[model samples]
Target chain A: MKYTEEHEWLRIEGDSVVVGITEHAAEQLGDVVFVELPEIEAVVAKGDEVCVIESVKAASDILAPVDGEITEVNEALTDNPGLVNEDPQGDAWFFKMKLDDLSVLDDLMTEDEYKDFLG
Target chain B: MSDTLRRTPLYDLHTELGGKIVPFAGYAMPVQYPMGVMGEHTHTRSHAGLFDVSHMGQVILRGPDAALALERLVPVDVAGLAEGRQRYAMFTNDKGGILDDLMVANRGDHLFLVVNAACKAADIAHMRAHLPELEVREITDRALLALQGPGAEAALNALLPGVADMRFMDVATFDWQGHALWVSRSGYTGEDGYEISVPDAQATAFARALLAQPDVAPIGLGARDSLRLEAGLCLYGHDITEMTSPVMAGLQWAIQKARRAGGAREGGFPGAERILQELADGPLAIRVGLRPEGRAPMREGTVLWDAPEGGRNLGGVTSGGFGPSIGAPIAMGYIPTTSAQPGTRLWGEVRGKRLPVTVCDLPFRPSTYKR
Candidate 1:
């Protein structure tokens, strides 16, 4: 698993990368009440905001970590947004994107690097 | 946190309870504790929640003409207010705009006023400049704390007896550990609770005593806000502002009949011409409760429209968030009188997408005030 400066975690699966916010972001956002995911099969760039997450306090956006096409989105979040707060890194993965170059993941930060960045 | 921000009497206790300190109205106050906003909100609805509202200004108006002098500023009937009773009031500008909303209680010899934190200085100055004959003394030695929710009476009564017997909107003086507490059976959250004015030195101890109760927990500003919104209450800086009139904000109920047209003591207050006219006729725009169809909350400043594509720009949301008690998104905003009816359909633009919203009767939840 890799991390982005925007507090998103990326997990590589075959040619696709699963993306979700880190626990730090979830904790900062308080309880997740609503999630608006990007359309499936939508193309996106690294800096594009692909999702919107609404917590009890405020609304925040989830930016795409790398240039990719959104192949899948977690629909469960629409019915149960609290899942993002409960299992942000696992079952709450927002979307799966198919990237042109999977090697782009190497440029991201490791777990240790993410912790250092947080510090 | 900035060094210039003031700290409340409960600052140490808040830090001890793992409260997330944030800047609010020039004070370093807790937005939420370790329980988080959602838990605190629900807890306050079911149990009792203690809020350190010491940031708000507390003032004592004394002199033989205090009530009459205060009536010159607000639209409410101050002279008609009975002793030991509290009434909601607002300081209106000359143009009928709201300067600040406040709570005024007739405490027999003197009147106690509670104004919003952000509007404290202006409210004080306004009162002093207008009511120069009266004493508008600001009480800095007292800290205001609100104990709200269904279990508030039991928790507060356990420590300070006689609070449970006070009816809603009733004010009384109670003794607690040698401190004279100005207790009022009222609160911002539409709950059966009390707002206690304790001495600054004893504020923390009194709060701790209440927290010791099995039904009491420490709540923060975040929950206080959501709870008030759910109760369909107007936030001073949000739902009502200097640009908004009391009638437009649906606060005409606070204006007493004695202060209206044809009454014995009518039209002596500021903005009386405009306010009385609005009361007799109607406001062009009115504040109404809005509920978004989806789980996504329509926050403040979200624009409203008549159509999803492009129709007419109606108005904007003022106070909005996910109402924990209602289990959905609820909001309050100003819209044209034509579109202000409950059940009227409207659209709020969020992230450039128009989402369906319905104008509903406010308080998404019913109030449980001990009336």
Candidate 2:
């Protein structure tokens, strides 16, 4: 799993990768009341806004970490957005995408590097 | 945190309780605790939430001519406010604009006031400049705390007896642990609550005692704002600005009948002519509650248009966010009087997306104030 400066995490699995917001992002957003997900098979570029997470305070945009086509979105988030706050890294993963460029993963940060970057 | 940002009496307490500190009105205040904004907001509605509102300014008005001096600045019927009661009031400018909204409590011997934190300094200066002959003392040595929700009265009553008996809008001074504490049965969350003014020295211990209760949890500004928005309450600078009039803000109820047309004390305060004229007819624009069409919450400063694509701009959103209690996106903003009617369809342009919205009756949720 790798993390982006925008607070999103990506886990590479073969030609596909799973994505979700970092726990830090979840904490900063307070409570996750609603999550607007991208449609399946939607092409998105690196750093492009793909979804939105609305909390009680404000609405925040979630951006794609790398260029790819969204293969599957977490449908469970539509009904129970609280999963993002409860287990952001696991059950609350936002979407899975088919990787268009594997080299983009090298640009991301590891778990330890993400912690140091936050510090 | 900015070094220049002032800290409240409960600053250390907020930190100890894991509150996320943010700069608000020149003060480092908690925006939410570890429970998060949504949790705190819901806790306040169902149980009780304790808020550290010490950043707000507390003032005391005294002397023989105090009431008359205050009456000259605000349009509310100050003289008519009975002893041991609080009334919502606003300071208006010569142009009929709201200088600031405030709470006026007649404590019998002297009048007590609580003003918004951001406008406190300017409010004190305005009062001192206008009423130089009367006594205006800013009570800086005290901290103000609000305990709000359905369980507020029960939690507070455990600390101080007889608070449950005090009806809504009532104010009185009572002894707590041998210290004199001034309390008012009022709050901004539209819940049955109490605002207690305590000496700064005892603020920490007092707050700790309240938090020890099963029904009480330390809430922060984030939930405080959401709760007020759910209850359709206006924020000071955002919803009700100096450019907005009380009448246009839908605050006509704050203006007493005695201060209106043909009454004994008609047209004495600032902007009297314009306010009275509006009261007779109606303001060109009025603020109303709004419900957006979809999941995307329309934020403040979003332009409201007559049509979905393009048309005449109606007004703008002053306060907009998700209402946890309502379980949907809700908002409040100014619109033309013609469009102010409930069920009027409108469109809000946000980030280039035109979203449908509807004018609705305030309080997206019913007020459970203990009146």
Candidate 3:
């Protein structure tokens, strides 16, 4: 139930947070054809651009959720670009980042708040 | 930015993806996504791609003698067009200028017309105004998706079945989950694929299913442009228009011989006199393909020169880009017929730099047609 103003979503998973583009963003992009992931161990800060997500008509940069270092990249979408368009929330996540500021989550919108913001 | 964009069922989808939407022929369409244009262009050529072309007009022409009447408007041999088959044709002004480019398909009893989204209204209005005796119906609610790439046929065949049987330029009807769809083996991208017309209700689902295929991916307008550019197909407003005759645009093959008969030929269409005259003699200016010496993309309005070193300015570029399939920059333009020969060297002024260019065949890419 976490969100970045950029429309990325995160779910707390004990030591890490699973992140991906929100349903709203996915629906807006029409069909996401490809997701470019950042390299593992890549360092980043809050509001920093790290990755990219491409759709049928356009490509979107994946803004960092919080200051962190990328630990894992989603290799699944390399060959199958449509993975992001099919499941932006569940399977289309570009990568995982190790938080530099663990509580940067405080600034992000919750699922309900983001939904309301969209409304 | 203008509120004039006619939305498709996928409008909301484009907005959420951070699509940089722009007005195109009255539709709010994405020009390029955040990845910029080059990546989007490359992705579509090597892999499968999807496109939302719902803004294009789908029309139905019906009347007692619709086929015979339509033949008068276009040069393609309409009588030979079998049911379920489609052919590209143009509406020429009496003076021979191209009014519009459209696809005329025989959907059993009547003719189904698919016109460019931007020119549809004028095209329809022109039809109703001139052929008052004929019936023209606009099917505005349907949405169109173009699935193009080397893998399109296989991906679609796995989902829709029977659709693979359609060869290049052929068509077939399939029932996807309950909605009837018209799928054709024609596309703007120089790939083996199809352009599908589906009811709005089923368009998204159809797109989803196609995307689910292992090879299918969603492509945007950006890639679509590069693909078409490499293929050397003309875009209506940029390549041909009512002010430009078919002969000048290098579309003489579209005029059927029977339609070319005296009194019935070119001038009878639009600017038929100019078109017929251009055919009898050669056009003063004609569309030609251009190959630049460098990789920079030459764009519309770039001045053309007849000599490599400041030869007299002969014409200008109309559409140009880094063609994905061609693996290089390509351009199209109207140049003097005297300089239209392949290998004829020309110069394109890009950003004040006169880039050396060569006149090539109309299609920079070898057109792979099932015919």
Better of 2 and 3 by DockQ: 2
For candidate 3 chain B, the 10 contiguous residues with the lowest summed lDDT are: B261-270
Every candidate's chain B TM-score: 0.99, 0.99, 0.93
In terms of docking quality, model 2 is medium
Instruction: Give the Cα error of residue B84 in candidate 2, in Å.
Output: 1.0
**Judged by TM-score, which candidate is best?**
1
Candidate 2 off by > 4 Å? A39-41
Model 2 RMSD in Å is 1.5
lDDT of each: 0.94, 0.92, 0.77
Q: What lDDT tens digits, residue by residue, belong to model 2 across residues B283-320?
A: 99999999998767888998999898868899999999
Tens-place lDDT digits, model 1, residues B1-371: 79999999999999999999999999999999989999999999999999999999999999987898899999999999999999999999999999999999999999999999999999999998998998999999999999999999999998889899999999999999888999999999898999999999999999999999999999999999999999999999889998999999999999998899988788888788999999999999999999999888999999999998889999999999899889999999999998888988999999898999999987788899888
List, residue by residue over A10-118, the lDDT tens digit for candidate 3.
Answer: 8876656777888788767754544557788888887777776655444568788787788888889766656776788887777887775568788889878998899
What TM-score would chain B of candidate 1 score versus the native chain B?
0.99
- Every model's TM-score: 0.99, 0.97, 0.73
Q: Which docking category, incorrect, acceptable, medium or high, applies to candidate 1?
A: high
Instruction: Give the local distance difference test score of model 3.
Output: 0.77
